[model samples]
Target chain A: MPLMFDHVYYTYDASSPLPSKAIEDIHFTLNEPFFCGIIGQTGSGKSTLVQQINALLRPTQGKVIVGEFVVDSSKKKMKEIKSLRKYAGLVFQFAEYQLFEETVLKDVSFGPKNFKENEEVAVEKAKKALKKVGIPEEYFSKSPFELSGGEKRRVAIAGLLAMEPQILILDEPTAGLDPKGAQEILALFYDLYQNGTSILLITHDMNVVLKYCTSVMVLHQGKLLGMYSPLDVFYQKELLSEAEIDAPDLICLVEQMEKKGFSLNRQNIRDIESFVAEIKKMKGEVK
Target chain B: MKALPIGRYTNYDTFLNRLDARFKLLAMILFMVVVFIHFGSRAMDFTFYGLLMVMVLVFMRIAHIRIRQLLRAIKPMWFMMIFLLIINVLVVQTGEAFYIGDFPIHYDALFNTLYTFVRLILMLAFSLILTATTKPMDLTYALEWYLHPLTFIKVPVHIIAMVISLALRFIPTLLEEADRFMKAQASRGVDFENGKLREKVRAIISLIIPLFVSAIQRSTDLADAMEVRGYDPNGKRTRYRIMHFAKRDVLSLFFLLAFFGGMLALSICGIDFYAFIL
Candidate 1:
């Protein structure tokens, strides 16, 4: 399913005395099966932009189109909002805090049940999601609160997965996790994307964007600077500095090498391993 | 939810905002009493209440509060105001009566309802002035000072004041957290706005449970933080902010006392100002 935002503008507390524009003139479209990263500093409207995808927040102006559902500012009510929610699942930051059911299976099934799946089907979907996240069957019946921090986060993600959303929007999914744990969670999402799920990841880490994202959208002070390929975004030092975004260390290293008269192919460097291989190939050519 | 006007402090460099909060709190209580005063005569009551309304409005102006804010403060009481009107019309049947169809509407009932509504508005406006002008920390210090006398009776005034301050401080934080949780659950397909009663209850449970868990966790974290900073609930703490009663506060107190005494005299003298108007 394709997701599109048309001239979307959102203001928090619009009727209040101190209205603030959280996102302004945000226009973007995501074709299916694309792993896109949204990068900005804190309070740059990344979360506000994603919330409109599933109609958690209606735009103050313009509209958001998600597949067949439309959330427009002119309309006060939409019947397809619930369906839209089921089609686009949002995993909040520290999502594990949202888990409250007595058992892990029940917690995971909550989303499917809310979407009107029958009890048996909901339980089955929940079990499948749990297994997909690698939770053992024996732990399915245990209290979700009994799980460790990482396991609870996985369970929370499983809760959303049970809804079978085509577009998964995660806001800082790896925040506050150990390095290995964060890598494991990102790998799981990458695997899902590999099997044809569209992923929208909101992150402050530029390295994560270069490593995992096909394209990246830059937001600066609630405005979309532009959307570009990951390599293009990383190569523009002026745009990165203007947006107050730090270039990933790999890109910085490659730039330093180029300044010292060493020719390096920026296109071939996406991750540390690939960048290392590129350097070795350069050495071989020089020899 | 939009930020409620009550308990929200707006920063402004107005005269009322600069006044001591202890005096402000006392003046607020005195104003409330003044609003509740009745002269037992329609003309006197109307005239006195009208004057009090003007005074309250002037106070709001001095505090740099706009009409929009005053309306916002009264918005939440609309349901209760309507309920009060309905109850008065139904239960109190006195004075001249007229029938609309079979139902009889009494003149006294309507008059009483109007008076009650005006009183309520005046009370709310007074409170709005107090809260909008004073900072939360200053309010707590004033409360602690007032409750200092209770320490002689073995009350934990310092602890009570601390609790109140913390509660005030966390109101916005908790509200923001609740909003985030609601959105998270909504993304999972919990339709909070439209659902049957059972479904609504279930939806609310989904929200409340998460909120409750997060609240507890937050409090635990806060407790740990306070402990790490060596916050001793029973220890003697020196005052960081010492409040002094200024000349303006003294003048305001005298004015309040004079107004209260004059109202008491009118109530006792039984002078029917309505008869004089006639």
Candidate 2:
């Protein structure tokens, strides 16, 4: 399903004495299943922009179009909203803290049951999602809190996945995890994206964006600076610095290599391993 | 929604804001007692209470607190104030009857209702002034100092102070957590606001269950963090913030004492002369 944000704007505590502008004039469109990364510093409205996908937050000004669903400032039907939420599953930061069911299976099935699904179908979906996320069956009957930090996070993501959303929006899914745990979660997301699920990752970690994102959208102070391919975004040092965001590690390595007069092809360097292979290829071509 | 106005201390250099917390607490208690006594006495004119309202507004202005914030602070009590007025007007039926449509209104009840409304409003305004001008840590320390006498009766004054301060610290954190829980559940198709009574209750339960779990986890983590930081419930510790009562605090105390002292003299010396003016 396609996701589109048209001139979207949001204000926190709108009627309060001090209304804060969270996002302003945010315009973007994702018509295909592309791995998109939203990069920004803290309080840059990255989370606010993605929450509009599932109608968790209605835009104060313009509309957010998620395939057939439309979320605007106007009133929305509960059924329409429920369906939209089912279509676009949003995994919030520290989502493991939200787990409350007795067992992992029950917690993972919560989303499906909320959508009015039958018990058998919900359980089947839950089992499939749990298996897809690589959670063992032995741990299914255990309390969600009994699991380790990474396992608990995976269970939380599986809960959203059980609803079978077409577009998966994650806000810092790997936050507060160990390095290995972070990579494990990001690998799962990359696998999911490879299977044609449109993924929108809200992250500040530039390395994550370089390794996983096909396109990058940069936000600074609630304004969209630019949305372009990752390579194009990598070249815009002034824009990146203005947003107070760092370029990806691989991009920095490639820049350093070019500065040293090693003419490595930057466009082909997406990850560390690929960048290394490109350097070796350049060495071979030089020979 | 506007956030709850607790812990909203303005950082302006004002006499009220800079007054020692202990003096502020003592003055507030004494002033409230005098106001309540005046309310019960029925000797002073209603205009005296009006003057008190003006005085509070003046205090707020001197403290650099906006009139908008004062109104917002009292906005939550409008319904309760109106309810008190209605109950007072409907129940007290001893004075001369006045017609309002078909219902007869007692003159004594009307006067009593006005008096009670003003008293309640004054109480709220005084509290707003206290909370707006005082910092949370200062209030906690002032509370500990006020309750220090309870230590003789084994009331664990230090522990009580610690708990109060921790509770104040967690209010904003818990609010943020609850908001996150609500949005997370909302993303899972839980419609909290627009549903049937039963559905809404179910949605609320969904929110509360997660919030409860998270709150417990937060408390446990806080306990661990505090332990790691060498926090002890029974340990002798020095305060980080030392407060000294300065000349401004003395001036505020004098102002409060004079105002309440004059109110007391008026209440006692009225001799029914002010009732004819009302």
Query: Top model by lDDT, which number?
Result: 1
**Chain B TM-score of predicted candidate 1 relative to the true chain B:** 0.92
Per-prediction DockQ comes to: 0.78, 0.60
CA lDDT, every model vs. true structure: 0.89, 0.83
Which lDDT tens digits does candidate 2 get at residues A59-166? 899999998988888855545888888989999998887787889999899899889999999999999999988899999999998999889999999999999988
- Top of the candidates by TM-score: 1
Each model's total of backbone clashes: 0, 0
Stretches of candidate 1 above 4 Å error? Answer: A259-262, A279-287, B3-7, B82-116
Best-fitting candidate, measured by DockQ? Answer: 1
Candidate 1's residue-wise lDDT over A100-133, tens digit each?
8899999999999998899999999999999888
Q: Over the true interface residues, superposed, what is the Cα RMSD of model 2?
A: 1.1
Worst 10 residues of 1 chain A by lDDT: A74-83
Indicate the docking level reached by candidate 1.
medium
